[model samples]
Target: MNPLVLPLVLPGVYAPQEDTALLAGALSEEPLPPGADVLDVGTGSGALAIEAARRGTRVTAVDVSWRAVCTARMNAWMAGVPVRIRRGNLFAPVRDRSFDLILTNPPYVPAPTGSRPPRGPARAWDAGGDGRFVLDRICREAPTLLRPGGVLLMVHSALSDPGRTIEHLRGSGLKASVTRRHRIDFGPVLRGRREWLRERGLLSDADEKEELVVVRAELPV
Candidate 1:
């Protein structure tokens, strides 16, 4: 797949990493109706949301970081796509709305320390301890926001347990499956946690790669 071109990335905002590309590639293959309502949770540089808008979907993007929100808004404007950008954690800003599709590349890197999510750029990737801090919430809450037949596409490291994601979505009554996977070299955060992760049995000492998986979960019509 050709790389999906992205707009400007503001400092402190998450850029379009491998996980983002994997999810975007899956999004490109989806059969979306014109004007389909789409929501992008934790939208960083607005890459996925803007791409959805390019496909004729009405897209709304939400993020917990003000910088991310601003970056997304600017990117949407630069891309000449009308995307509704809001600032809030996970699904809070869209609690009362329903969407035909949802996209997210949430924080899934296992942090070795406290339960509190760390501040700064690390917030984009550091998930407390088990790395389910954001993923679990998305699985539990996203199904509630989907319209009948709506789909949610999310990407995360295999270290975070893609099976758990599928299970959680299935438990919520959505049919879910892993749609794509890509093995890539460890990024700085993971590199820093390599030993700690190995000690926790989440990673092997010789492992230098992480598998990123894109999950597709859909509501039945």
Candidate 2:
């Protein structure tokens, strides 16, 4: 992988990672309409949102963390892009708005089940034990935020059950599929939870890699 050429990424905001790059690459392949409305859920540091704006789309980015919101705003300004950055969880800020494209790289690291995700830096990852804390919510709520024929491009670790995401999107009447997949060694968070993951039977002691998948879902026009 080449070095990630990114705008200034401030502390406390989620920096772009492998999943972010995969989703961004997938976003580049999308055939967007002129001045399409785009939503970047959980837009930490506004990476995906800025990329969408660079593609000439009108972008809105939202995050629950004040630090993240500030960081994203700074990044957008530095990139000379007009991304509407808001502070909210998931789709709350844009409840009534619909988008032509929705891009996300939500938290998906498996943590202990039933334990609340930690605040601070861990908030960027640290999903519940199954790693679906954020992914499930995104799959459930994101489709409703899509305009007709709109698309959602979400990247998450396959350890979180990518199949379940496809099923949920399909159940919601969107055509969903895995558009991209890549195997990468575990990052810090996952590496720290390596033993726990094995205990949960989600990983094996010999496994050092995890698969990241970009799930694309399109609503019927």
Candidate 3:
């Protein structure tokens, strides 16, 4: 299925990129019962939320950046989708809510140690250290937000350790595995941090590409 095209991306908000497209593609193939509840965590431009909404699911999108919240709201409006956009870090805004599906293309770019947590546009992708900063939290928290038989679809770079994500989710009693992977040339962020990544043994000097994987975790009814 073709990835849904976004309507607008405001400055400081993350624009839909390869990771976004990968998650959207996975969402397209997911089984969504009519009126299923869906949550798009760290939703940057409302792309995933709008896509789910188009599929007749009830979508609520959340982001830490107010600019991102505004951008997503506008994009949803432009797409004529009713996505309830909220501003907060991760699932904080939607506490106590459960959903049949959850989608995220969170920040998984490993930043150097001692680097301050990202702000502004950088917050969209600059993850601290091993890049599991946000990913790990999601692994721990997402299961609680999923209804029985619900699924969580998350996209992150292979460098962040998909194995660990799978294990973490499984430890939480959810069945998790990598469902898709796509390799692409390192973007500006990875390219600029190539040396740092190599120092951490997460990347090789000769490697110019990074693999992005979509991890699907399902809750048994």
Candidate 4:
């Protein structure tokens, strides 16, 4: 990964990649009211939490990996912000807490024909046997975790089937909307990283290009 790192709302940390810059920018809306509780799901490196905390929102950040939880806490301290980083899968850690804003960057990449991600945190980047597992779960559970009129913001790849996401969210009883989007070339990431796909004969010879969608859904007031 070339020792990739960048200065964020925090300092002195090496992030595994540069994609967080895109995530941070796309999640630019400061959805927290001062004194409001916020939940950051899939707190990879805690960029979203740090940014929200920088604006004075109390944050509870969660991730499946202990390493990710540690990283989020470290980033929060480095940023001179305080965040509660918890270790758990999806929303399991906060089943009892409702928030005014829930921000997530879930693995939405549907598993390609035969490919699967390497076990562990790699799945954080990979969505599923095709990438919608986490997204589907998030949409399905977001309504219950959100306060009335609260919002959920998720960044997902177009490969996750944006249409399906919208439909799923609406079916889950949330009002969904497309808030932002950017096209990302999957060529580099997918080219040399298809072993799992090849193992399952899931990958085609076709080159894959993808769109990244930043969606926001509001729970009814």
Best candidate, lDDT: 1
Q: Cα RMSD (Å) between model 1 and the true structure?
A: 1.2
Tens-digit per-residue lDDT, 78-131, candidate 4? 779989999998899999889988988876655543354446645666666667
Across residues 76-107, which tens digit of lDDT does each residue of candidate 2 receive?
89889999999998899999999999999888
True-vs-predicted CA distance for residue 105, candidate 1, Å: 0.4
Off by over 4 Å in 1: 1-3
Q: What tens-digit string does per-residue lDDT give for candidate 1 at 60-174?
A: 9999999999999998999899999999988989899999999999999989765986799999999989999989999999999999999999999999999999999999999
Off by more than 4 A, model 4: 1-19, 112-118, 193-208
Once model 3 is optimally superposed onto the true structure by TM-score, how far is the C-alpha of residue 163 displaced, in angstroms?
0.5
- Ranked by lDDT from best down, the candidates are 1, 3, 2, 4
Better of 1 and 4 by TM-score: 1
Q: Identify the runs in model 2 with alpha carbons over 4 angstroms from their true place.
A: none
- Tens digits of per-residue lDDT for model 3 on 1-221? 23456768888888888888889889889989889999999998888898899988899999999889899999889888899988998999888899999999999999885457887788889888989889999999999999999999999999999999999999999999999999988889888999989999998878899999999999999
Superposition TM-score, candidate 3 onto the true structure: 0.96
lDDT of each: 0.91, 0.88, 0.90, 0.72
